[model samples]
Target: MSRKHLHVVDSSSFELNIPEAELELMEEMISAYEVRRLGSRNHKQKSVSSDTAVIRSFLTFIQKAPWNATTDDFDAWCYQIGREQKVATNSQRKYQSAVQGFYRYIVDNVKFQAAVLDRYNLRIIQLVTEENKIPHVHERQRTNERPAFTHQDFESFIGAIDVQIVEAYKFNSKEFLALQRDKVMFYSMYVMALRNSECCDLNLSSFRSNPNLPEFGDYGFASVWGKGSKGSGPKQRAVAIDHADLPPLLDWYVNDIRPQYLQKPHCDPNEEAFFLTERGSRMKSGSLNYRFKKILGYAGLSEKGFVPHCLRHTFTTHASSAGMSLEYSKIKLGHEYAATTQTYTHCGDEFVNREAVRYAQSIINRLSDDE
Candidate 1:
């Protein structure tokens, strides 16, 4: 018999009942693996705990010890969780990796492998094989693709914000000042093509005047720390404040609205953050996402799957349609590659139709002149 067939037959004949001694060995194996990961890999306790949970789940699903788990069992478990539970592809990969890591730990420790084999008469083998495992990808993956907002949708969204602000002010609602801050926050994200974290991380001194753009005063350009690559730190860039209305609005917020936040109880007078909560702390990314979702629903766009990141995509698309060069857009958005900026630009069908009509009109004019 083939080695694989012999092993499968052996695993089949073993008693299904797991003794207390076997359970202790399994727990010991997991604990040793966790210690190795914590010391050598510097994995966080939460991550280690997650790995342990994944191994236990796989064990429960297979109804066998890790040593007796076959590739078929692993594949069936993957299909059950992936198809039935509808887990995301990235999450599926993470779970697969955790199991693979555990098996690797077993294979490397001969003493542990022998302990399990001698006790249970079953040997641990690599379960995650090339044909069965989900391939690791370096590029970021989005399970749900978020579409960019159309111009009408964006206008309606902004109009909703304005209308709510007016109502809040008229009724003297406690959120009146907060709504104003959110308006500026959303506007800045779109106009500057800023990531939500970058917007939330802004401070009072993040903006400064450009000598060439005298009309903008001190609100000419915003210096922000852009999102970095996997291990690298934040990449700093100066995003030019190009919109005519934004500078004045920013000036108004700085002079009028921001001070109100500072006046709250226990607020630090020396706090340098540009956007502050009613509690006087800097705005968090989660809070910004929650607020954006509320505004999206108010604007009747909640069903459209639009997230705050779509604002950055909207900026790139609108900028491209408005005759901004792709190279400039790349620089403005702090993208390392022009191709990355291209991915963000999702122009609508109207822009394409308009360009086609303009091209045909130019051709007709040329024919008339020739005649």
Candidate 2:
């Protein structure tokens, strides 16, 4: 059991008596929830810790065990958080997510439900509803959170990584190999706009040459297992890596740089991971994060409230600014809804004005050709 658990009852609240078995179930659910949260989402500590706090707060507010709580109880708890606590909309949604996961465990996990019911004669019910969910306001619009990095900024970041690679090579440092891999990993991410987990999960089989575009070689398409909502599991999508510049970079990395990471004496020749760790195992999202942080630090980027996922935002903004159609960008980014993809776009005024002129000039040129 997590010793970090919080007390769920107060002296002022109605006295509550939970069966030992039921209490144990709650603890177990918390433990399992932590594992599930860490495994699926890239959230490390904040999810498990904050979720536990949210669960404890919900339990304390209700003054009853989870199974005994009703939808009305949950509705009130949400109301209190938003109205009294005045947490930001995003915080409310996080609370929703934590509670939703608990209820899902209670409702879906047959073993958990059976054990609790057999021992305590209690049935767990989902108290959360769509009615309880806070509407998602696009943070890009609202708080100016991590305004998408411009293409120039993204280039600077990649260039900084390049400089580090050169410096490591100059020193003949062992870090040269790892820096080379980071370059490919981050470059692919920027050009293709892959999620951190998606990029981390890449293996040799994830790429294929577009027969029609022989120049791109095996870099024309990338298979991505993208994140879906909780319990939806990962949905597979194909991202088109058709940009002319992207293909050459990917080709260079695959042919030249990737083999270096695989050359250890003990390294398995059959290891198919596109990106390998120092140990020759597949790269993990956390490892990807460390390299991402190093890139950000070298690029002199502010690390506050930013993560590797922001690269996806940068890709979306740059793609839109460059006149990629929303439908094309939506499919490329693996967003199910066009509106969701819009939230990632952060095109600036200059790009908008330049693009307007380009569009006008193209139409004028077309008219001249017609004449």
Candidate 3:
């Protein structure tokens, strides 16, 4: 009865079906998805593309209507996405959510139920859960590996990096290049929750103006190219920087401090590397680990297992306590799966309380401003 049913590409042309009526219903369900997604002004193209691909692939692979898909079919398709297609685990989880959400929409869509269930006793059920995805924390994280950094510890770490620059010489003088570079690198990595490589790979041109967040100016979103190891070619996702405090820091580094570090003889003038060593070139992930070691030592934190990756862990823990959701945190971390994000998330009462009050006040201010 919905407008989507009238607009389906094909009314009935499927080989396999619970019945002709069921197949038409499935088409209507898919049309509904297309309509809703297309109608949204802020539609995520990547999400829509992947969700449609999952549904169509499963439909073709199983040669069955979606309403009749069994748990076994869902399992087999997952195996294909994981092993055969070499999709990242997080991506696989995303695809599963997409599939589940679509089915939920189809079944729960009360207005269209008569079109779907007139003949076949149809039901759509979720096939993914926390246990199924790889969120089980490995034993190493629990015992030997460095624990996620607390908010106070993160502040100490930044202070540790900055104190080196302060102690060495006047700020931004020739004596300060290395320390300044490291300081900016450390904070930028923290702000974006970037993996070491993603941080290192970042070029000056990578920062672009996002119109949606005009207040952050040109440095709000970070589009990081990563996750190639999981067999899906280099993945790129944009992360929004919470920039109430980041702009001035990033600006000082980009304008004043960065040029000082790029003064090596015969340095590529066009070289846009965001973080650079004295010799100049992309700063490798290993160099970042060395810097972490040095800074952690200065801060009196054990540097043995506390590596650059731990900065990412620290970012996640701090962000979660600051009221960032697991979904946005995953995007910030460039994680394919939310479980991988949960592996790093920790919250302390202090940070949560501070963030909660700030957020509540912000809401109150907005309401007042409206008046």
Candidate 4:
């Protein structure tokens, strides 16, 4: 199968004709890899999704390229496609990563030799540099800043969700179920600090209930399979349940609601996905986003640009403000780097003021003792 002839579809129903075993293997690799890297050092969730997408594209790209295609061929494809779309630098990096991961999988798992894989890796690195130096059609100035959110804005958003629930009561049962689902889903995304993919990929099996703990362990923590979690590295991490406000809704959905709704005979037994569409199928990433937007509007939180990830930002901000250690927060968030975790350290003015006061007190004490 040539890459050019390989069919990529925009709709969900479109299926590729790749061997079932191979396709299954690829999916397993993606899932298993994510699980292993979840709590490991140097594991990044963002890179995982990008890499998977890249590898899928690469499979098609390779099928189309000439049998005699060399490193130059790969380089050309990246430049042409990447420039045509005016992809950002980070996107280019992800494309490179995906190709590299694909070749690595081929070498490590398939009939290909290790030497060939090593050479391909080297070739990819060389090509990435070559392509990066050639400016794309849209070369915008790079900004080194990160996005920040204040504590008050976070509180206001949560307050708005409370208001939404009252309005939701006015709707009938079915409409109210949809409304509550969206509300709880947004809350889960923020409280759990999950990526869009992680949020969408969740299944009933991911939640493990333990009713025996001193506190309400009835709502067990979720096992998250992070991005780039395939192959040899660590991939899975657990998010502990703590907040009193969030757990009841989560438990309700997991134990009572999901089983009632997803128990239809048409529902695939193999698919134990936690979130479902009204038609009783596993939710797609797009649906998750749609639901998120709908709920945000209902909550009057649309003004905050309250996307799915903003919830994650909310988690980090709240955790940091609560005085959780940076190291602990990194582990909880499943971030591989302290630097990536540091992006969430935007404390409230109260926290900043308290720290300032404490520091001043320490300084005064030190000076007085010296005198």
Where does candidate 2 have its weakest 10-residue lDDT segment? 1-10
| Tens-place lDDT digits, model 1, residues 162-245 | 999999999999879988998899999999888989998999999999898999999999999986542235789999999989
Mind giving the per-residue lDDT tens digits that candidate 2 earns over 1-371?
A: 33223233233554336667657767787788778777766455744676767787788777777877888898888888777666666667877877887888668888878876887688788877666687666555653675678777787888998899899999998889888888888878878888888998888899988888888877789988988754456788988886788877777777887777678898897998888899888999999999888778888875645577788888888878777899998898888789888888887888778878999999999999999
Estimate the lDDT of model 2: 0.78
Cα TM-score per model: 0.63, 0.64, 0.56, 0.60
Q: Which residue runs of candidate 4 sit more than 4 Å off their true CA positions?
A: 1-88, 91-152, 155-162, 209-213, 229-234, 263-271, 348-350
Q: Counting only residues 3 or more apart in sequence or on different chains, how many pairs clash (N, Cα, C under 3 Å) in candidate 1?
A: 0
What is the clash count of model 3?
Answer: 2
Task: Output the number of the lDDT-best candidate.
Answer: 1
Model 1 clash pairs?
none
How would the candidate models be sorted by lDDT, starting from the highest? Answer: 1, 2, 3, 4
For model 1, the superposed segments whose C-alpha errors exceed 4 Å read 1-144, 360-371
What TM-score, to 2 decimals, does candidate 2 have? 0.64
lDDT of 2 at 363: 100
lDDT of 3: 0.71
Pairwise TM-score winner, candidates 1 and 3: 1
- What value does the lDDT take at residue 40 in candidate 2? 66
> In angstroms, how far off is 259's CA in candidate 1?
0.5
Q: Give the worst 10-residue stretch by lDDT in candidate 4.
A: 138-147
